[model samples]
Target chain A: MSGRKLIALWLFVVSVVVALMGFWFMATRASMDYWVMAGSLILISITCYLSGVHHYLTTKNRHGRYIILYGSVVLMVAGLSIYIPDVLDLRPWEIYTRIPSDFFFSFFMLIIGILSSYVSFRPFHNFTKEGAQSGAYYIIHLSIIFTLFPLFLIMFNIITRGMGGITWEFLTEDIVSMGEKGGVYPAILGTLAMISLTAIIVLPLGVGTAIYLAEYARKGLAVRVIRTAVNILQGTPSIVHGLFGYAFFVLILFNGQKCLLAGALTLAILTLPIVTRSAEEALNAVPGELRDASLALGATKWQTIKKVVIPPSMPGILTGTVLGIGRAAGETAPIMFTAVYFSGTGTPSGLLRPIMALPYHLLSLYRLVGYRDVEPQAWATALLLLIIVLGINLSAIIVREKYRQRF
Target chain B: MINKVLELLKEEKACQRISLPPGIKAKTSGFSLWYGSTKALKDINIEIKENKVTAIIGPSGCGKSTLLRCFNRMNDTIVSVRTEGNIWLDGYDIYDDVTDCVDIRRKVGMVFQKPNPFPFSIANNIYYGCQVNDMDVEKDEVVERCLKQAALWEEVKDRLSENALSLSGGQQQRLCIARALAIEPEVILMDEPCSALDPIATAKIEDLIHELKKDYTVVIVTHNMQQAARVSDYTAYMYLGELIEFGKTKQIFEKPREENTEKYITGRFG
Candidate 1:
């Protein structure tokens, strides 16, 4: 091996030795908080080893070495604090004790650990190209891993606790009884109705505004101002929008009616920016030459935009719409002030009546934990919400891919 | 065979250098062009004729393409650019108060240097022009006839429903030609049509140009003097956005013309 390769081998050996020593120190230590101490030592040993290896290897070249070192250090520290127990702590199998930490730990651990694992498995060799590992790829892998594990756990939990009560009576019966026999049919309908209404209000306005901004808006002060406004809208927090919806749509416009329309409108505002940005990008991606060619053939500007530009961008626009739907369906904070109701006697009869959404349903179920029978219902609702979000996102991505192939 | 064509062109230029016949009855007078505030073409005067192939030959920065674009008013789409030109087509001023650009484009069609076909069926590409011009007649017949006029009907007839992009470069140019012809424009302006095609495709386009004069007036800009000689009925030599010479193609190619036009045609400083 070359001197550089030999140095790399030596550093790897040193790291393994340190890790082994740290593991031994923690494993043998009788202290109650040895898990925390051992975890930190193990983290430091791994960091030192990896950084030493990288520093030696890149003595002549430095581009991404520091980033990897810093990233590893961060992950190591986070891993130690979150998961590695603070001294052989023993606890009973309470769902609350295991649930929150498990959710957060695996979420962070699987994500950072996968990346660190990949780096550990495939150290940056001289042959690999730079900037090849992108954020989108990382997010996609992390999402799959995080989404699947929780989903599997939820499914297992639901089957063990939820299957017996998932009959037609449990599903179709009303929640008026405030007990085990009450069904979720009204809640389900209210949620569906609100989501559908939100889609109706958002699609035309979102797509129209996107088209106008992308195709018609000239590059000037006003256009720049409008673009900045849209960006601001996108960055604004959901809770603020909920407050605005409650003040305006619920209180003033509908005379204190906190109905489905008010909630739908709030969700529409929340989803608009996402759709507009994606649609704008898709529109911008259509080659200028296509538009020129169409116009040169005597088609009007509107005609060119309609026939040539929009058709090609349809897949991207649809993807944006799907993403917006996903956000709207999962949004709870905005709907809380403007739409959700826990004590409705029955399903909403019209647009003016208040409704229930799945996220709000999930949130409210948290309050029913003391009741034994209602616990199963909450888990089932949680599982259903996850299913809906995942289903929408997966199908949208698939459809977008199919259309991309066509183009 | 190449030498023979060159010699014929030289001999023809020598004999008819003294007297030149005016080729165009239509002319653009006091014409000036601007892109934003920068002038691309100054006030220029030139005339073009009916049922004749006129070649505008110039070097890279000479604005030959710009002049051709003005013929179809294709430059109108550039928002910051402005023009003050009186272009007359058969005694009707195309830049006058009554002129609609859509109508002007319908009457005076254009083909770009690059072969840009829509990502659609070959039939759709051809019919796009016809439909846009509101010539809503029998679609297939129009497509067939325009294809025939472009001398591309035979090769593409079997694949009318196929995507236009699937065709060869030469076929795509011909498809663009058929597209222009589908609108039945009185004049067709081609800017370096052969620049992007291979020798065989260039020759095919030359053949198509020869056949095109039977129906429509054709204006082509070319760097190849041989192409100008073989296809055009009239030739206008230009340099630095100024028209240096304009005459019959036979006369311009053969006789003792201005020294500049001669030096250019004789493969001197282009």
Candidate 2:
């Protein structure tokens, strides 16, 4: 290797080692002496500076050089403030001392590692198009990691904390002593019944509206008005939908009774816009040439849609509808007012009967946290809700991959 | 004001129709079409002879495809399109208020420029037209007859259950022809059907057109003048939405009638 490349490689290795030490400190919550922290910061900052200079010499691009230098200098100055506070005169020495040592060390190490690696890769790429492309790939991969990290963290936290509460007896029995014990069998059944009814009500209405909008409706005032209404409906809060369902379906239609039908209707209304918009997109994704070919073959407009357009777009429509249903399944606000009771109602008995749903039951368990031993049950209910929603979403993905049409 | 101008042009062009021979399967009389405000076909008057290959040849955007689409009322699919005057199929005005467009389409089949096969088995694609038309027929027999008529039976007979989209471009175009034939329409309209095919595929389609005219009346829109000369019995040359000349293919290619026809045929100007 050339002299410049050799030096860059050595700096990259040192930066990675420092980063690993920083991670160890953060993970174990270890306290470091002021001298050790200061020394590590200085080492990382010098490594960053040399690598940045090496990249600048090779590529003649000042952007990466200035950025790396700026990051390293800021970290070094911050690190020095805790040790020699009067030099920068930015903050009181007491304030700098109060800041946790591990947090500062981890943050400094992360920045230095990122900067060093960027400069290390730059020497290899030399700021060519391929270098820019590789740089873009790295940024995108980092962004994906950032997005998935929080989701996985939440799932891990829930599964670990909730695992103890999910026993066979916990799943099959009714609530005892205000959910201090017993399972959520009725709540599970109630949730299944509500979502199933919601799907039945929403699918035909959403798919029909989608077909009309995509196939028959002209791009005029009526279509524009309908599209705007769907957009507004989709953005409306779930709480408002709950209130409206209480007033309309419960008060007017059911003679002041809270029922499963009322809650399913509200959810159907809540998810209608999602299903309609997605189904319309799926229908529109079908190429116009296919419709033309069908029409040119002496098939009527309706026949052509039924035979040619619907078959290819069915996968997209189902995926969107399943996603909408997944959203409907987890929603607590809309059903709490119109459909679910706190505890009295066991599994659903009739269309007009109120029932205990998982989300509402979890809410009740959360309220009884201090007075009763229900925290584990609350966590278990949350885990179950997550599983149901994720399961529905996974099925949608499977359906899309299985039946996806090319043309 | 546009109607008055069209009426005047109709009178001026009345003498040109006098020389047209018999066996008129479809005819357009002073038929003009506008897409929104843009006129695409203006005062087009031509007669399609029964059981003959009639080719419409002109430069791009000259209303040759528009005139071909008018025979089956296929242009009705475009929302912006507006038409005046009438197109007659088998001596009946197809644009009349009482005429059912579905019924008109059933009697007249169409093939498009690009091979657009439905995402179905090859046999199912052929069976689709019959199913929609409510025709009770032996499925195997109809599939066989139509494929044979399209000259694709031997090539695709074993793969009848395969997706039509799996076929090669030439095979797909021919499959589309077989699908069009399944409904048993009298007149078949082709809109630049071979434009997307290779030279050998184009040759196959041209040969199929020669065999097709013995039974079905064929109205083809083509950009290739040589194909028109080789395949067509009657040729119509149009320019800027108006029919410039209509006569035997030999005369249109040989003797001079209008100056525009001579210029376009001689490559002097489009």
Candidate 3:
């Protein structure tokens, strides 16, 4: 090998070794965090610096890019290892003195290594084609893995941990002894009731608004204002919707009682904008020629919309309905303040009575996670809820595909 | 084939004025239309005789379709469209204050360029107009009659419940004609009805138009000069929102009155 290529190769080897040591020390010797973190930072920084220098010397060599890849990876390992222990902390430095020494050292080493390595990579500002390609791949592949890993891991963990708790008795029986035993049947029933009620309230109004926007109303100031209001309502926090339901529906509308109706109404408000926007898009997709053909046949405006336009756009509207129902099924905050019944004395009956919902029940039981049986019940309830939401989303996609075929 | 027909017609009628036919079914006098600020049809004057196909032949953007739409006040659908004139139908001014827009449209059904079949069973597509217009009639009788009149009954008779969109392009356009006939309107306005069809489909539509003239006053707008000659009895030639020539199909084709008409007829820069 040429002398420059040998140097680049040597730098790459050292970087790999440094990244492995840093990852290992961060995982295994977390208690000896100061030395492990500081040692990793110092070693990886040296590897990054050596790779940069080696890359500069072998600019014309094909292996130059391989050197840049090692330098970038060494820096990535150093930063991740440093930030691992206290990733949840939004402000690490402010609580540095209050935190344990191990956390402080790791955070400190992470910050220093990130700063020094950033400077190390600055020399190759105009990167070679191969280096940028590998660099782009690292960013993208790492992002997909990191983003999806936790979601899949949580789902997998819930399935494995919760499947044992699921039984016919567990699903069909009512809660007993403060949810330490029995099943979540009442919560499941209550959740389904609330979802149906929400669909009942939102579907007609949302579709009406969509039809008016798409078919009747001209593009003007009034329409623009309504569209903006819908967008803002969509972005409004669910907690705010919960609070609104509590204040308006419970206090004024229903004479100060939290019930299934109030909770469903709140969820309807949350999903109304989603339904309206998607349904409007669906209605818009109906061909203009169809409308023309109907009107030309001496059908009135309403008749044209009813007979011709609505039938073709039904699948699209149903897709929007599925999406709205899915969102309503999983919503926690809206139901919490207005409907959830955790420790009620007697059996809750009718729409006016407070009832148990899976999301709020999950929230309540999660505090009792120290108990043995409570943990499994909580996981199983979560699994059930996930399955419901996933099923609705899958059906929405299927309906949308059918709608495309019709057009 | 149309040019040859015009040649024979010229020899038969030697310099005689083309008289107005027996009865004028629909006439537009002092008719003008404006879209927002631009005039689309200017001072249009024309007569549609009864039991005949009146073809409006013009280049694109020459207001042929606009003038045809004016007969039923279909232009009222456009918020920016303004009309100032008289459109007389059956000895009554259709643009009068008492004229119901719905009534005008009911009396005058329309067929479009593309075959739009409502994505429904063929039987339902024919029955919808009658149902929506509140016309109480025997559904099966009307369906069979209209389909036969359009020459589509034999092919679609067995599968009346099948979706109209599932038919071939030619069948769909014929079905649209049958749909127009189901309402049994006095006038039927067709805007480039055969434009989206193949030669065979176009031939079928042209033949149907000939049969329809026995009952309905058919006003058609066509870009193809040959289709105009093949289907229409009276021809109205328009250019740039102005009616250039209004005469029998023979006069318009054989011996032109205006230089502009001759140029346009001979395929000089439309």
* Model number with the top lDDT: 2
Per-residue lDDT of B1-270 in model 3, one digit per residue for the tens? 999999987776443222344598888888999999999999999989998999999889999999988888778778898888888888667777666777878889899888888888999989988998999899999899999999999999999999888999889989988998888899999999989999988988888898889888999999999999989999999999999999999999999999999999999968
Least lDDT summed over 10 consecutive residues: which range in candidate 3 chain A? A117-126
Chain B TM-scores per candidate, in order, are 0.87, 0.91, 0.91
Model 3, residue B62: displacement in angstroms? 1.4
Ranking by lDDT, best first? 2, 3, 1
Per-residue lDDT for A1-407 in model 2, tens only? 77556755675576667667766677687776555556766765675566567667766766456536654774665466476432243256555534465566566666656555554555455435675576567668867986998899899999998888899988889867767777898999999999999999999999999999999998999999999999999999999999999999999999989999999999999999999999999999999988888888788999999999999999999998899999999988999889988786887999999988988888898998898778999999889889989999999999999999987
Q: Model 3, residue B113: what's the lDDT?
A: 86
Return the top candidate by DockQ.
Answer: 2
Interface RMSD for each candidate model? 1.8, 0.9, 1.2
Candidate 3 collision pairs: none
For candidate 3, lDDT tens digit of each residue in A1-407? 65443443444444345444444445564655445665665565565556556656657443445444654664555555555454345455565444344555544454444333333333333344654565456457746876998899888998898888888987888888767888888888888888888989999999999999999998899899999999999999999999999999998988988899999999999999999998898788888888887888889899998988887788878888889889988888988889886843234488898988888888888978786458888888888889888898998898778656363
Off by over 4 Å in 1: A1-173, A176-183, A343-345, A370-373, A405-407, B1-25, B223-225, B250-270
**lDDT, candidate 2, at B135:** 97
Clashes of each: 8, 1, 0
Error of 1 at A317 (Å): 1.8
Model 2 chain A, poorest ten-residue lDDT window? A84-93
What TM-score does each of the candidates earn?
Answer: 0.76, 0.87, 0.79
